[model samples]
Target chain A: MASTTEILEKILTSPPSAPQGIAYNYLVPNIRGLETMVKTLQVKGAQASGYPTPAASPQSEQSPTSTSASNSSEISLFAAATETFSQKNTNCSIAESLERCKPIMELAKQNNIRVRGYVSVALGCPYEGPDVDPHKVAEITATLLEMGCDEVSVADTTGMGTAPRTQKLLQTLKEAGILEEDLALHFHDTYGMALVNTVVGLEHGVRIFDSSVGGLGGCPYSNVATEDLIHLLHSLGCETGVDMVKMAEIGDWITKELNRPDDSRAGKATLARIKG
Target chain B: MASTTEILEKILTSPPSAPQGIAYNYLVPNIRGLETMVKTLQVKGAQASGYPTPAASPQSEQSPTSTSASNSSEISLFAAATETFSQKNTNCSIAESLERCKPIMELAKQNNIRVRGYVSVALGCPYEGPDVDPHKVAEITATLLEMGCDEVSVADTTGMGTAPRTQKLLQTLKEAGILEEDLALHFHDTYGMALVNTVVGLEHGVRIFDSSVGGLGGCPYSNVATEDLIHLLHSLGCETGVDMVKMAEIGDWITKELNRPDDSRAGKATLARIKG
Candidate 1:
């Protein structure tokens, strides 16, 4: 975690013609963490182009990691929509957490590295339950955007967000004039509503989504269920250049690696098609 | 499986007025099965009112189980939208199977017993894949409805259906002049697309949905994920008289009984609301 050697290696090795909006984000808690990133890269003789950041100097006292990378990998800071989540997650109150991120955001801004913000449990909280008011989410969102964070991803940490609450939260943000394209929906399939929420998000004009490989983290509702999401998206005529067959193949391999049930329907169905 | 003793007992004990479309459907494979049903009911001395039929003579010789409950529980017959699925599932071609249902539908009509139809893999097939033509599903649906089946439930058995495919299928049905009210959507959360498909189905004016309790049966795409569908529906101002709290409690109990992880988001969240 300290070195981020693995992440940097992947970033350095990534194809040049990768699609737009590609980001590698790390959860950088404090300025010291940022300084360590730069210091470690320097000690390892990493290049700036390896990071893709142009003017990113991790700390005032140290130099940037590399001069070649035009855009530094993004750093993400967190807050919560509810009191208990903030306390449990960040060990602070909601308002206090945002204030803390203000400095981190400024640091990233100065280094020419864009920071991403996450509002966890934006739809519902484990300790406080659902009904974390949409206004509270909107307020936190506005603050994150105000703090010069590139964008805020509102996370339904509890997987408790359904179409109604997700829409309500989005509506609240939209009414406050938050651009829909500026938002990304992060969902969990704890109860299998992730894709349903995806439809709602799409209807509300949200284009960005956060997802993982293989519905990992044991939540099947993550970002539309991998290839199945892409399949659904493809069916809706959204051309994601992501090769679904390859994605499903990866999903199959990883689920086996983890010894978890392969929950990807499109993956399984496509596999079945191949056999037939 | 033959006797409906427990089922009848439950029905008899059910509240005086239950919600519309509460069905206790039995899969009647053929005439022998139909005869056995009536003969068993007759031997049990089941009243006509209890059976909910006025005249359903088993095969012409046996007398109708007394002038039953004026609307006996319905029977469901299965067909498939794809040839491979039809052959694999029911051991016949799609056309041949619909041919098979024709007599059964006539028999039910004569007996004053309604029959429901199920079109499996209506959205996508495991063997044939996602390209199971919408026209085939529409044609089968039309045949079933024309055969006097009371309603047809389009099933995404492989759970490969996402919003786009589901919408396309529903659009095909609509183009074929099928009434949305006469249709039910039975989905599997194979890729967690059930609720997303539900949104599309709702948009197309189809209301009835098929789901499992506790999102039981290990399918992640149950509509009961968070009571959110209802929440989603209610936000659109559609009143669903379902008691969500009771539903969640029952959901919790069932998941515990099955020793399966409790996967209902609304069930868990709503319970949290109560405890908090």
Candidate 2:
């Protein structure tokens, strides 16, 4: 975790003329992690104001203080939609997990930072069967919204979602007064429904979607991640703010680095086309 | 091969009310296979006309005789658009393969059977690469048509075709005086672009397509079959005369039988919805 933070900082500081922004993830495993992040932000702010480095150009100088400000103001937290998965993943029941997040949400409010909440296992659960009630999903979503989350992302962790189920789930959420803009969908392509599910989401007016670079993350149960969603989004005429060429290159690089088969259909195809 | 043939015949005969049709694949590895099929058809036709079994319904007895009478008039053949693949797969150079096919085509003409030509590796080849000259594809297509093929199916055996490439290829074929009605498309989804490529083909006014049940075949190099083309066609409001439910069930059954994961996106999604 610390190495990742350091690498992020190095990347941000390398280019003086580049427009860099800080993304704060609140994995607040406990209250200690949250406090540590707050303290780190304060220390960084003070250090940037006191010691101005030559590498910090005029534009970068103005952005230096803003980085800490932005980092302090935006944080992301996640909870699972089903109690079984929430308890298993977070070591707490769904209610207890929400309670655990109370302090983090309060801290974000105190600091005037926006909090983004995630509801994992929205489509189906590995532990539980496939009959995920959309009403239960709506209840959890309502709770997160009431807790002051600016937006909530629903994830199909097991990649068991289909187009009709996804559409039905979205309709239920809409009926519960959660507009489509307040929702983001994350799909795993374990069974190749990620793209179709994303299309269903788009038809329901969803815009923001969560996709990992090179489809990095995988479900512990199914051991699959959402790889086809990016290509599907591109086909739907949506801009993803991702450089597909670089993304494909990185996909190949990382698969080689990790000694795993490149799981991405688009990545493999693009490589084949470019190589040919 | 014998076991597969038996299983196919059992499935066809046991389903008393099922629609019966012959796929009649054109690309035989050699003339020996063609002769075997021709002999089988001849014997079957004679037996059906000589004595209709009590087990065979009136509909079945009449249908087979007429079907074989119509089918006995034609045979299908295949040629590759690229030279490297043609030599590698067919064990003959393009010119040699064409010369070899002449006798087969002549036999078909003598039998009064209409011949259908398939141009494999038309979109791209893993060995020779993606810059398969459209002119070469057109020339092969025209040659096949001139050789008495009633129609041609252009294939993307490597599954490396993209929308633009497919569009350009189709445009070239159209410009070469090949009507879209006489052209069919065969795409492999090595890169998850098969459906989109199909959409491009649809826009180009090509209608006939070749798709495997459950996307059964996988490419050796690319490792993914072009599966979701049927679902995409259905989504686009095109009628394919296929029962989606039956197709999904067959896809699931075949995947289970092969001990391989079900690769069809539509099949998986539909089954998931049904189960959920």
Candidate 3:
């Protein structure tokens, strides 16, 4: 696990590579993690315009940090969509985990940092089979949004999402009066349905999705590949501000570094086209 | 590389395990291959159903075998959806390959044996990249269908299909007055988009798909796992007359035989579910 300083160092080093107006999110596990992130932002004092300075000393009392910024940085916390997942992953009930995130959300809000919530196992759980309920995901999303999360990313933690299931969940959320802009999608390629789930999400008017470059893990249960995701999005006439050729090259580079086969078929095919 | 007799032996042994009423298709590269298939069927007299006897000797001329079968079997041939792929793969132009298939199609029709056409690189070509034109795919599909092909399977030969591209190809076919039932989708999991492409096909009213048991090739260029595909289909409420449990077992068995990873996320997940 990265220490607070290391995380901050990477964040500091990250901006040049990220597009402008990008909101960097740090996953905060506790008050300390949240404070570290705020402290880092305060110390940097780089392009953090329109926000008041942090307290000279770390505030022990629960008080607003007295700042506002144009939606730049945020901290994220998560709750599981299924009871078994919540118990096993966080050693608590879903309610308890959401309770835990409550303070972190408030703390981040006071510091003018956006708070993003993630409902893990929104599609399925490893311990629980593929029948995770859409109502539960909707309820958790409501709770997160109610607690001041700027956005809630519904995560298919074990990638058991299918188009119909994904549609059901999104419909539940929509019926629960959740704004489309306030939601994002996180999918895994465990059953190779992430892209299909993504299509469902897009059809349901969702524009935000979570993916990593070449993704970070191997499948039957890993995150979606950014290269593959972006390629799909672009093919569907969605304008993503990503240079696919560059992204695919990086995917190739990183997969080679990790000594694993590249997972994205599109990435490999794209690279092959370039080579030819 | 298998002699005519060897191929027949496998088929004879295969039926008990295969789903009933399955229309087995053999890839025919030349007239000799077609003749071999017909001659074998005639010699066996086992489940030949309605097919007439073949010539005692392999016919040297282009005369169609005088026979009919109760949808017992069919033969398939392919042309690349892209010019470069056709040239590289078949050592001929797409039109030339189609011309070659024309006579084969005619011969199959005369024999009352079904002929299924496959347009490889229907989504993208290994050498030409992903901008393969939908119009070209439409023209080939029309010609193949016009040549009395029972159906045309659009093959994403390199698994380069994304949802939009897949939709585009289907739209072109639909616009060209090709009946939906006269289409099948063949996808490789090459960028892990096979299932996604399948979803697009389903949305477009195309039902049939091609999948293998275990992934025997590298990712981004292998057939989608049947277990994975069926699971997705089932989740989407497509009642495939497939026994997924048995399918998963075969997937496991074959992967073990190949000493490679079982790439079907649903296959492994389902087997785990069964064990638990």
Residue lDDT tens for model 1, A210-244: 76666676322344467666766776788788888
Ranking by DockQ: 3, 1, 2
Q: Candidate 3 docking category?
A: medium
Clash pairs of candidate 2? Answer: A73-A113, B73-B112, B73-B113, B74-B113, B74-B114, B189-B226
Clashes of each: 27, 6, 7
**Could you tell me how far off, in angstroms, the CA of residue B68 lies in candidate 1 after the best superposition?**
14
> How do the residues B137-195 of candidate 2 rate in per-residue lDDT, one tens digit apiece?
99888888888778888988877676778888999999999999889888776766676
Residue lDDT tens for model 2, A1-276 = 466445434433332322344454554556665566666555565665542232445666655543432222356778888889887888889889888888988877776667888888888887785568888888888899999999998888877676667888999999999988888888776555566567678879998777665566575423222345556566555787766666788788987887876667777667666776
- Which stretch of 10 consecutive residues in model 3 chain A shows the poorest summed lDDT? A62-71
> Which residue segments of model 1 deviate by more than 4 Å?
A1-23, A42-72, A218-228, A255-276, B1-22, B45-72, B214-276
Task: Specify the poorest-scoring 10-residue window by lDDT in model 2 chain B.
Answer: B65-74
Task: List model 1 lDDT by residue over B97-195, tens digit each.
Answer: 988887777777766677899998887776787788998889999999988988999998877776767878898999999999999988776555666
Q: Candidate 1: DockQ?
A: 0.31
> Which candidate leads in lDDT?
3
Residue A104 of model 2 has an lDDT of 85
Chain A TM-scores, all candidates? 0.81, 0.82, 0.85
True contacts kept of each: 0.43, 0.26, 0.75
Give me the runs in candidate 3 sitting further than 4 Å from their true place: A1-6, A9-24, A39-73, A217-220, A259-261, B1-5, B9-22, B46-72, B82-88, B91-96, B106-111, B127-129, B217-220, B259-261, B272-276
Docking class of 1: acceptable
